[model samples]
Target chain A: MNFPSKLIEDAVTEISRLPGIGKKTAVRLALHLLKQNEVVTEALALAITRMREEIKYCQTCHNISDDLTCSICKSHRRDRSIICVVEDIRDVLAIENTNQYQGLYHVLGGVISPIQGIGPEELKIESLITRVNKGEVSEIILALSATMEGDTTSFYLSRRLKDSGIKVSSIARGIPVGGELEFTDEVTLGRSILTRINYG
Target chain B: MNFPSKLIEDAVTEISRLPGIGKKTAVRLALHLLKQNEVVTEALALAITRMREEIKYCQTCHNISDDLTCSICKSHRRDRSIICVVEDIRDVLAIENTNQYQGLYHVLGGVISPIQGIGPEELKIESLITRVNKGEVSEIILALSATMEGDTTSFYLSRRLKDSGIKVSSIARGIPVGGELEFTDEVTLGRSILTRINYG
Candidate 1:
């Protein structure tokens, strides 16, 4: 059967690409956009466009930023001596929202998974090691997922940083198995951060 | 606590404006965009930008279109003599997906609701009457919602078109009350189309 016009079709297709948004949901969303005031729709579209055009990864923490260095990395209020390593920037936001974490972040971009063909070299692991070797960071917090890939990356990083004389730690066990840090509510994430344990 | 960066915060705020997307989902979507290849993220952003920049309404039917007339309205295969009136473009799509109706469409933009201050004047009722007055159309189908407002609009239109020497019909009653056409499965919508009844 023939569907909507090509423009509507394309909008729905793009919206469906987002996580958890199926075809029906995408169509609903697209129609809602069409129903909204032109200004709101324009703002939403412009936001997506600006995100791609203006935003870039922080050179130090790999978090999203409009400049070379993210605010967390540049801020004097944050403790640069403790870096919390995470698989993605979503984790950084999750932790930041809790208003608990005072240290800086190190987004690894991804975990090491041989099956998915992602390895240490593909991540920011080398940069992390270099940062640790600088002798400034006293604690490296592994806030990666509890998945097998996350476990592997954590072990590899711990072994590599063993002789760096810095304490290597992982966030606490309140996070459920296979649970994404993005899905964890702010309260649990804050509690997990406060009760972190030593990894080595 | 201090957040990651203003750029990340702004991107998340924009993403959250989408339906069903909360602050957390927005952050996840933004992070996913950040982790993706620049080309892919740029493509998604470009799609949104183009949606705002390129898409426009069909002057004839009011359905979303890139040109003056939507594809369905422009197509010679569609029966211009039978114009199906719907509440929105999404309804037009649902009807099209059935592959049963071969007629053109007229999108009303919304239904008449006294509570919401939406009246016949606010809808495309005037344009519909004008289209019918041209004498080329023989049947005008009301494929609007089954809500009270929908019924009110249908009754109002039926009264106005009583002497127009054209048949006014409505899609069947099987459509659940308050259920949006976008959510109705193809089969149910198709069946409703097949079971349409004369309104006036």
Candidate 2:
């Protein structure tokens, strides 16, 4: 579309470069910014730039942090002996939202994916191994997705850590709490039955 | 959600302020930006900031512009005698995308919504009158939406422009071209029957 102003066109062009944003959505967002107060735009722009420029990752866990070590990894109350390994910072946030876990996280940055040319070396696997070598951690939980890449990463990590004698576990997969068995997929259904827990 | 970093929380807070973006999507987008190279975020932030700070509007039509008059209003190829009145700059972009119209446009900025405390005085109705008083225009099209506010604005403008001797018309309303008859709503179907046209 021919924009009446180059600034709007340029803004839309840049915004559409992000994941899942199309030209139309970018246009809508850019125009919304135009309708808002300058302070709003200023704050948004500043926040984005500051995040990209000044944001740091935890040296210990590779989670998003403004300091050398993330808050979760540094907190004495958190269970340092159990590390939950996940794909990225968003997964850490998701797990944190459940309020079900109080352990430190090891952000692998991404999982093993041959399709995208990403492998174990592309992730922070070496750092994870280094943490495990310290021997303070007793158990490591693989909290990655159920996708092929997630499974591949879990397998590789388990094999590598087998010699180290640390227990490696994965999050259980079953029907979601509110889901019906009739609607559950075959693989999950089969696994749910095979991994059934003993009744109390 | 507990963010590992304050900067991440701040960024998510600001990004989620846009329309339709919630806290979850904002966190996803913020993390996506973090995963990408710094230049991506830099470009996005720069484009938004530059657009908001340096944008200009057309003096003649009140549309977005980089200079005094917009390109369309200044173009000799477009029909200056015809003006298509619209709600805002997005409408101008939408109509332009059709590649069907070759007329000038006057942006009213907004519709008459008493509930929202917006009225004729709050919009560019006076400026539209001023444009018509120049005596250069012969036809004015009411290319606004088909809502109550749009109809009220059109009626008010027509009443005010009765003495100008300029032809005024609105775009046709009926079932959308590819719309199914069974799914068409009552108002549109009723209007289609009432405004039946002759076919040779």
Candidate 3:
């Protein structure tokens, strides 16, 4: 598409670099910003630049933080003896929203995905090991996704921590709480049956 | 959602302010940026800021431009005796991409929409009239959309230009070029038959 202005073209090109946004959507967004108040654009630019430049990763858990250590890792009320390991900071947010877990979290950043050129070295596995080796943590909950990469990361971590004597457990994989039995996938249904709890 | 950092939350809020993007998508985009190199975020922020701050509007046509006058209005090859008016700058780009029209363009910025509290004064209607009154133009083509607001604006412009002794026309309305007749909507099909063109 021929842009009337080079500035708009450059803005659209930059915006379209983001995941899931196309050139058309980028154009729409750029035009929208143009229509809005200058403060709006300034605020957006400031927030993005500040977030990228100033945000830090927790030294202990590798989670995104404003300080050296994340709030979850620093909170005295959180169960320091149990660490929930996950693939991303968003996962930590999800589990935190559930309010069922009070444990500190270890953000792996991503899982072991060979297809995407991601391996154990690319993640925060060493930091997690160091955290576990401190011996204050008694159990490690593998709260990663159910994908193959998640499982591979879990297996790799378990093998590495086997000699350290700390218990390593994975989150359950079964039909969701409200899922219909007939509609559930075969593998999930089988796992649900295999891991069924005893009746009271 | 509980953001691990205030900066992330701020960035997400700003990003989600854009049309068609939600909080979840905003968070995803923010994280994607965080994962990328700092130059990516810097480039995006700089492009958006520069575009919003430095872009100019064509004094003659009201289209977006890098200078006082847009390239279309500045070009000597374009026909000065004709002007195709549109509702937005994107419309100008769309018509230009067709390569069929050699006339200059006038961007109205938007059509009249009372529901959105937009009035004729808010657009570039007065400037269009002023351009037509100069007597250099003999034809004014209304290339606005077929919506109610578009029609209202077209009618308003025609009324304003009725005594100017210039030909006022609108782009043909019918099914799209590649559209199938059987699946076309009744209103479009009816209009297509009513305004059938003569064969050469």
Candidate 4:
């Protein structure tokens, strides 16, 4: 079937590329964007552009930020001696929203997924090790997902840091199998944080 | 609760403004964007910017275009004498996808909704009348929604065009109540087009 103009089609295609967006939904969203006022559309565009141009991965935690270090790392109130390691930045937000954790974060960028060809080298594991080796951190919280990849990464990190005299603990098991922390409701995430158990 | 940095909050808030998006979903989407490659995020931003800066309403048909006039209006193959009246540009795209109607389009910008404070003057009805009065248009198809607002606009237009001796028709009644033409499958829309009835 003949589609709308190429520009419209292109915009739909790009929107569909976003996670959780399908082709039909993308078309609907693109049309909605077109229907909106020019100012709203421009704001959306600017948001996307600024996300790419202005934001960068924090050199220390790997969390997204507008500066060399993420706000959590730069904050004086956050305890630098306790590092909470996570699979991605969303986990950082999930942990932060609890208002429980006062420690700094270390975003792994992703877990060590063998099936997806991702290894420890592909992650921010090296940076995490380097930070731990600096000798000030007393606790390392493994806040990765409750999945095989997350388990593997946790095991690998614990083994690597076995002699570092640092306490390594994984966040608790209330998070469902195959469920992402980002999608889990805040209360459940809070409970998981409150009940975290020692790993190693 | 202490949230992530203000930048992260701002980004999520901006994403939530899109249709059907809520705070949680917006945060998920924004986090995804944050994790994505800079090139992809930049492209999304540029698309939004281009849509705002480049797109404009066609002076004649009121359909959105990147230039002075829409491609359909500028094309020589489309039937200029037959003007298909639609409620919005999305409807124009829906009809265009069918490839059955080669006629020109007249976007009302919206239907007549007295309760919502929309009136005949609020639509592009005057421009439609002016176009028909210029004497080139042979047929005007009222391809509006079957809702109360759409019916009111169709009735108003039919009465206005009655004395002009031009054939004014409303697209067939098989369209479901409160159903937008853009959401109807192509076959149904085409059938509705084929079964249009003459208006007084």
What docking class should model 4 receive? acceptable
TM-score per candidate, chains pooled: 0.81, 0.96, 0.95, 0.81
Ranking by TM-score: 2, 3, 4, 1
Residue by residue across A1-200, what tens digits does model 3's lDDT show? 88879999999999999999998899899999999999999999999999999999999998999999898888989988999999888898789899899999998989999999998999998988888888899999999888888889999999999999999999989999899999999999998899887899
Candidate 3 local lDDT, residue B16: 97
- The alpha-carbon deviation from the true structure for residue B173 of candidate 2, after best TM-score superposition, in angstroms, is 1.5
Candidate 1 residues B94-196, lDDT tens each?
8888789999899998999999998888888888888898889999898878778888988988899899979999877667889999999887799789887
- lDDT of each candidate versus the true structure: 0.81, 0.92, 0.93, 0.82
> Every prediction's TM-score for the first chain?
0.83, 0.96, 0.94, 0.82
Count clashing residue pairs per candidate.
Answer: 0, 0, 0, 0
Score candidate 4 by TM-score against the native. 0.81
lDDT of 1 at B46: 57
B50-140: candidate 4 lDDT, tens digit per residue: 7656667788888877666888889999999999999987788788877789999999999989898998888998999999999999999
Candidate 1, superposed: residue stretches over 4 Å from native: A1-4, A174-200, B175-200
- Give the per-residue lDDT digits (tens) of candidate 2, residues B95-184: 999999999999999999999999899999888999999999999999999999998998888888899999999888889999999999
Alpha-carbon runs more than 4 Å astray in model 2: none
lDDT of 3 at B176: 97
Model 4 spans with C-alpha error above 4 angstroms: A1-9, A34-37, A174-200, B1-6, B175-200
Per-candidate DockQ values are: 0.41, 0.86, 0.85, 0.41
Task: Give the per-residue lDDT digits (tens) of candidate 1, residues A99-135.
Answer: 8889988999889999999988999988988888888
Model 4 Cα lDDT, one tens digit per residue, A1-200: 24435666667778888888898777778778876788887777777667656766789888877778777888999898999999877788778887889999998888898899999999988898899999889999999887789889999999988888889988776778899989998877897898876799
| Lowest-sum lDDT 10-residue window in model 4 chain B | B1-10
